[model samples]
Target: MSRHIQDRIGRRLSTVFPCPDAVEDTSRLGQVLLRLAQALAPAPAGNPVPDSFRTDLLAAVPQLRRYALAQCRNAAEADDLVQTTLMRAWENRSRFEPGTRLIAWLFTILRNAFLNQRKRLRREVEDVDGAFAATLSLEPEQERRVELIQLQAALNTLTAEHRETLLLVMVDGLLYEEAARVLGCRTGTVKSRVSRARERLALALGTD
Candidate 1:
């Protein structure tokens, strides 16, 4: 195995199987280590989570909460959604594909969780799409600034599906494929939504 693979396996093993130092038998310790190494090894075709997975999760929570809050109406709901997302991600960590965009994956989880919660509680009163546009519709003294704000607000007026597609593509800088994965849609769908969203925003802001 390459050094990279070995390091990854070592990290996973440490997380899953902490060695016991109380055992004075050298042979037993060796056996335990061997068992752990075997268990931590990657499958034939699948990439296991890297050592940095936990570190990445820790680093991403703040940004993830911010994104969730932007999508949600209230701080309490956003915080709950973020907490649930993190718990779910940690629980299903093994299923996360390696070398993928972790932030996108987390965002997808948060979005799904939010939708599910809304369905359960029937509390979909505040429309983020409308709120997003309203926030951006401010008139500033600077002509250049006002125009930019208007454009941003126009983007917010798009449907949830469209706004998400555009933000994931334009603001989040995700490629079509990655955005599709995050949105749980096909690449073609993502492309169409992004195109339609841009056109609508342009029309809404009288830039068409």
Candidate 2:
């Protein structure tokens, strides 16, 4: 890669410096060494991932996001899935082999993670068409007066964590990853809070 690319990635990844160009070598060991260097460059900011490795991560983001979007079909869920994949990949980077396809490895992790999430939500009914509001069976639940007042009161009763997650994901239309970025927590934590908050709201409103 060019020095400009390296320097740009260095800034983006919070690395203090750029890396030297790889020496020409056709040998397998040389190839492995180069790959390892790119995969594990030391960060000057005390981050484990250096500019070289971080470039790889940044390069993979778009593709990873596409895969996530395909799997979840929900922007928020897709962003959460992508964040989970990246976090897990960072934690388990040592398990990645040098000279192998890093993108393939990341894609594998994304697929597995998506499937696991699907398993967790399998029992719950999803409203893909936004039809839930039209299907309310109770007259009181459909009434505007009761809904506006009672729902507001119930929301006021939620813990800060639960309320924020619900509003961020539901009202603001932000992805879980975006909310997590704003909230300084993992996407899974945001997901849990939203779930709990919804349950609490349901219980308070006599909807569950």
Candidate 3:
């Protein structure tokens, strides 16, 4: 891997898989890592995956889950999208060009997979009216739940293009050029979309 790629993967690894000695418990991260490991287990006998490729792919799972959750708005669906992205990425590992942004390539696959799945799964119900929220047990963190609901509702109001661009740049930490590659658009377009997305999101949250 190139120096830049190594740096990027190292940063992602620190977030997705923190030093075990520093953190007492990482059951959540462990679960995600285990799922991704299983996803990559069936590589062809003769064509084994390289250590660097596996490491980079594993490190990207957290960002993938965030983007998937923003798009799907349901934890189960987001998990499925992430698993599908991992599976597809592993299967097409040979097509990936080295010395390039692996996360960008994975984002492209993830976005395409999400779009294809959306077509078949349009009937899935959403909590647009907050009816589902009413059913949640009133816990100490109910205020936090309400805030998240408001944020998700604000996110849902943006155009698909705006939402995707904002998530790629702001949430996933993709540079403008890398996000442009994933979105198949000009860097200027990505910038404009993110700017507008922030404005629209703020307006939706009644902060504009």
Between candidates 1 and 2, the TM-score winner: 1
Worst 10-residue lDDT window for candidate 1 reads: 12-21
Q: Could you tell me how far off, in angstroms, the CA of residue 204 lies in candidate 3 after the best superposition? A: 8.4
Greater lDDT among 2 and 3 belongs to 3
On residues 146-194, what C-alpha lDDT tens digit does candidate 1 reach at each position? Answer: 5555555565566778766776665555789988988889999999997
Give the Cα lDDT of each candidate. Answer: 0.62, 0.55, 0.67
Better of 1 and 3 by lDDT: 3
Top-down TM-score ranking: 1, 3, 2
For all candidates, the clash counts are 0, 0, 0
Give lDDT: candidate 1, residue 92: 81
Pairs with backbone N, CA or C atoms under 3 Å apart (clashes), candidate 3: none
lDDT value for candidate 1? 0.62
lDDT of model 3, residue 178: 94
The candidate with the higher lDDT, 1 or 2, is 1
Scored by lDDT, model 3 comes in at: 0.67
Best by TM-score: 1
Clash pairs, model 1 backbone: none
lDDT of 2 by residue, 1-208 (tens): 3445333222321111112123244544235335544545665565566454566765666556645553454555766776677778877877877665566567668767876787887843232232222322333544643553445556556675576456555543456776676566899998889777766656544553
